[model samples]
Target: MSPRRILFIQTQGENAGAQEISRLVGAGLGARGYDVSHLFFYRKSPSFDAPPNTRYCSHDRPRGVLGALKFPMQLLREIRAIRPDAILTFQHYGNTVGGIAARLASSAPVIANQVSARMLMNPLVRTVDLALGMFGVFDLITVNSSDMLMDYARYPNNYSKRLRYIPHGFDLKTTDLTKQQARAAFGLPPDVPLLGSVARLNAGKRLDAAIGTLADSPDWHLVLAGQGPHEAALRQLVVEKHLETRVYFTGELPPERIGDFLAALDVFVFPSRAETFGLAAVEAASAGVPVVASDLPVLREVLASDGQPAALFVDAADRCQFTDAISRVLNDASLRADLIAAGRGLHARYSVARMVDEYEQLLRDLLAPVPQLAPQS
Candidate 1:
């Protein structure tokens, strides 16, 4: 039997969580004898290298509405050429446009993967998604968190039967580094009570709240490891709060270096106002760093191990609550130990291998079976 050709379409090729998820799933399937390919809906080439057997199509258009409008046709052309067995798309623009393109081209079974709940905020997009679903443009709609799935279910025109929740997997790296060694590698002071978070410096991430917490607590330092459009504003805010010397912004660490960064942290903080699935928090748990995250349903679902919460939760809106949670984790040795132990239990359920296995099964099931012919009549 010939290997299944699975094509993945994503809005942007940037080094964001959705892009990373697509890469991991696509690469894993390719390794297991699936002919997997990835297509960027927009023109700008991604900084990361393409996975094996993956191809990126360039349709260079200036960013924003113009580019989004032109994307479906470009994507349709690619789908017709590839003639894939299955198509999976990630993010808002990709899902809506990719689904339409696949339908137009008669490409394959379309799987629209929603990584964030951002779509709910946009009425137009939600309307388009519903239209696509009703028209059978999307064969399946996958979300990473149960909370996000519930949010979509509440929509008036939702295609509830087509929705599926598939959690993101963590590909943890092994790092044999002591706290002191890890701090030195990242140029962080070994003595300070370091609070760390790995996130894009975006408004939704609510990193400014973390900076404010650091400002009030002179004894603690913060290290945010990631880059985004909000960096300049965040830096200015940090300066305004007089946290310049204490706050360290590690522009963007590569995948290998993330384990070392996690090793150096005293506590991991995820203060995002909106998070579909806190992948970074899960990675921190894998590293045994006690976490303090926003009290979101997605966090509760992902951070729970054996019916116990692996990480501390607090409302992102309440800065004091976030700080208090971090302080509790830092000041109580027993609490830290308990959280770390519980975090270790998450490794089995959220492994990259497990995620790939589930995705592989779904893709294979979606593949169109060969047509049957009547026996000699």
Candidate 2:
């Protein structure tokens, strides 16, 4: 049989979490002898890695409600032309616009990914998602965590049948760099304790809480690697809190260099108000760095344990609690070692190979011919 043609759609062509998933999944499918192509709704920056076959429609995003309504039609034309065996969309815009496009374009199965636990917090988004679900725009909804699936189960539909739980897995490969080498590359001093996070400087991430924790401990330095619209606000917060010297922003590092950044950190901090999978935390753990993160349900599901937790959990808004957790991890050598070991355990469970295998098998099953019932039955 010929290889199935799969199209992966993403809202943006950036190195954000969703885009990374799209790239990895597409690459995985391609390696499995499937034909893969990538589509991006917007291509503001050339940050995303467009493996072999990629297309950028450059759809103009108009302003406000009218623009939002018009977006799906734009996708409808493109999807109609490049009709593939199936379509997989990542994140909200892809799930909503690209999903509807896929349904209108062809009878191919449309797989929608839900990456945020709190995406429905917005009234408009919630209404849109529910409407799409009722219209059968999505054939299957893939969530990175069970906690996120539960969040969606509150609606009226029999979502249990359509929803699939697939954990976000990491590429276990590492860059050939030691902690000392990574820190030296960035001109960071050898002895200063470093606390780092790789996240977009957005309000939902609550990077201010991480900066606020810096005030509690002058001995440690905070390094943030990522860029977004909230950079100015976060910079002003750093100025207001007098954390200019202690806090450093590295803009957005390329995906390839993220491992180096993780290696340079003495401890990794994830203080997001909400998270669906906590990918960065898992990546930090994979790099053998101790993590202290917000006590969100998704974080607890991925990292915390009754036996030995992979990360130290703290209240999202409590800077004091974050500071306390960081202090304990930094002060105790034994605790650091234990956290690293726990992190390795998590890395083993969430391997990229396993994720790829599951995705491939699911796609095959979806494409398989349905069994016929016996005449007697």
Candidate 3:
């Protein structure tokens, strides 16, 4: 028999968490002799090097009523052409529109990956998601965190039955570059205590909190290493606080360079207001950097292993707590050594190979033929 075909649908073809997960999982499936293809609704970012066998539905994200109407038809055509055995959709647009298009175009099972619970805050979006679940628009919905799975389970009706928890996996390879070398690559000072975050410059990330931490730690420098809508506002906050000289904006770093970025940092700060999974924190830990992140349950789930926490938890909104935690990790040698040691084995637990194995098993189980019951006498 021929190899099973899989297609991934995501919103933007950028170097974000969802896109990165799709790329990693797709590559894994391909290595297992599966035919994998990636489809994106928006144009691929010029800086992003998308995986092999990728296609875009539009030159840019749909802007108006006409563009919105046009997207689904284009998506439907792509779905029909791919004729995949299974379709995995990522992000909001991919989960909603992509799921609908797959349902209309093919008999394949559709698995919608929900990377965040923030959308539930919007009543209209929540209602639409529930309605779609009730109507069986998707065969399954995968959530990266157990917190998210439980959140979705709270909704009434068939929504609970379709929920599945699958943590995002990472390669977590160790970088050969030393802290000094990595700092040199980013044009950062060689000796200063560096705090950094590799996340989008969005309001939800609460990057402003990171800037606040720098205010109390005059000797430290902060690196904001991603691009998003909130860049201008964050830049303004840096200026307002008179931290323009200490804060560095590296725009968006490519996937390959993420390790070097993490290597250069003394502490990884993740002040996100919300997250379905903390991918950046995991990357930081894997790079042997101590992490100080928001005290969110989902974050706790991702940053801990074997009941021991791998990061220092703090309130994302409290700059004092953030500053104190960073100070503790930096000044206390024993604590810092323990955190680094604990984080060293994280790669073994959240490895890409493990993630791919789970995905492969899930796909097989999903596609298996149901055994029929014999007639009773």
Candidate 4:
């Protein structure tokens, strides 16, 4: 028998959370004898090398109006060529455009993966998504957070029936580098207390509040490990507060260096204003680095194990609360040990193997042959 072919469709092949999930899951399925492939709408990020079996609808940065008009035909062509047994999609463009293309080009079951609640906040986008759900454009819709699953279930009509909850998973590999070695890689001071965040430098991330925490803690240095549109503004904030020397910007670290970045940090700070799944925080915990994060419900869901919270939760907007949480984790020896222990526990809670198992079962159920009924007498 031939191996089942599964294709993942996403907006771009970037080093983001959704892309990472697809990479891990795709690799897992391939190991299990499935022929896994990826179809990205835009060109791959320069910092992120495209994995094998990857295809792109556009070979450059997202084209403007002309690209949007041409995307359907391009996507349809790719779908026809792949001829996957089932299709899984990520991001808004993939969920809508990819779903439509797969429906038209193949008879595969289409699964739309929603990793963010931001789309639901937009009335027009939400309306369109619900309409597509009503029309059965997607066979299933998966969410990474239970809270998001509930939110989608509340939509008027029966759109809720298609929703499934599957939390994001991680490999949780142990870092070989020690604190001093990791710091040396980034040219950071070996002795200074360090706070780090591995996230896009965006306004919604509320990274400015992280800068504010730095101002209050004179002894601590901050490292912003990712890049985005807000980088220039954040650099200015570091200068305005005279923290140019204390704040380090490493741009975007490739996947291999993420563990090293986490190893060098005393406390991992995630002050995002919103997140559907607090992937970075969970990752920090997996590295056994204590975490200080926003007190969001979704964070509460993903950052807990056996009813114990793995992070120091705070109002990320409040400089005092944010700084205080970091201070407590640093100053109290027992608390730091406890948080680290709790964090290590997350390795099992969000194991990549477990996530892959659930996904495989879902595909099997979707592809199972329906029983034929007896002929009428």
State which candidate has the highest TM-score: 3
> Which lDDT value does model 4 have at 356?
91
Task: Give a tens-digit lDDT track for model 1, residues 1-377.
Answer: 67888889877666568877988898899889888888886434334444555544554543688665655556777888888889998888788877787778865899899775663347787778778876778888888887888887775554777888788887784589999999999899989999999998788898888887875678999999988779999999988887889999987766777899999999999988888888888889878999988887879998978988889989867878777888899999999999998888888878788889888878867876766677896
Candidate 4's displacement at residue 47, Å, is 1.5
Candidate 3 regions off by >4 Å?
119-121, 368-377
Candidate 1, poorest ten consecutive residues by summed lDDT? 42-51
* Candidate 1 structure, TM-score to reference: 0.91
TM-score, every prediction: 0.91, 0.91, 0.94, 0.93
- lDDT string for model 2 (333-365, tens) is 999999998887877778778888878877877
- Best-first order by TM-score: 3, 4, 2, 1
Error of 2 at 89 (Å): 1.1
Show model 4 residue runs off by greater than 4 Å.
119-122, 370-377
Model 4 lDDT per residue over 71-163, tens place: 778889999999999999997777877888888999999988987676434576666677778889888888988888877778755677888
Compute the lDDT for candidate 4.
Answer: 0.86
The CA lDDT of each predicted structure is 0.82, 0.80, 0.86, 0.86
